[model samples]
Target: MTAPSEAARYSIQMLISDWLLIDGTMDNHVWSAVEQPGGDGAADPDIARRPEVARLGLSVRRAGWDQIAGWPHDLEGFTTWPAPGQTARMSLSGAQWSLVVLALRYWADVDERMSDVDGAARSRGIATSVEQRLVSLGWSPATP
Candidate 1:
């Protein structure tokens, strides 16, 4: 099989560094999203949450990646369920999907837990599972 395109490689790197698989503690370098003295302040949380998670924190509460497995690798593609006529709609392009997969696969092994008490191990499991599913469909990571 041919190697991934240049754009895809860059997407993988950017996903790991900028979004998922970030270096250092989850608390480190995070913007100040809270305020003191009865004032309200916030940071760019948009940069932190997984694409599958929304700000209401519903994703965490529900462990929301339930539908992520076998998601399509191409924007034009859809994931088919074993039962007839069931499919998961994917909004991300092939490159976007790649970036997400790599980011989750290489997420930083930090000592933190979600508000719902899910720890790094659980997070890693989700990541690894998704990445594996993608690989099973012939998608390859840009790096090991």
Candidate 2:
């Protein structure tokens, strides 16, 4: 099997952030919609234009919760926390599904407990899991 594309790799990195994954199947393209504060519905224009974020092949928009992830759920995506109140929806193409599956596997570890009270513990678990998985995959962190 061939290697996954750069987009898939980047999507994995982006998923580490606190943004809910939005689905844009209707548009035939996946996009990210960030929910900001003070009645703001869109991502900060400046944030949306960031270089690294741009590299993920995503588009940002100002959307309400209903637009991001609500019923009538025909799209496929995941949602994260509410720091920037953004939802990222990167399109799945080629081998990106494997990374998504890995994300699902990771998320499954936390899906059991659905409450913010367990966030700290969950964060630690995710970090531990990722670190262990990475180490097993032959990755070594650089010494500071």
Q: Pick the candidate with the highest lDDT.
A: 1
RMSD of each: 12.5, 12.9
Model 2 segments beyond 4 Å from truth? 1-49, 54-117, 141-144
Candidate 1: tens digits of C-alpha lDDT, residues 36-120: 2234223334444433322122312121134334433564543332234333322233444444444444343433433433555
Model 1 quality (TM-score): 0.32
| Local distance difference test values of all predictions, in order | 0.36, 0.34
Alpha carbon lDDT at 120, candidate 2: 38
Query: How many clashes in each structure?
Result: 3, 7
Candidate 2 — what's its lDDT?
A: 0.34
Alpha-carbon runs more than 4 Å astray in model 1: 1-91, 105-108, 111-117
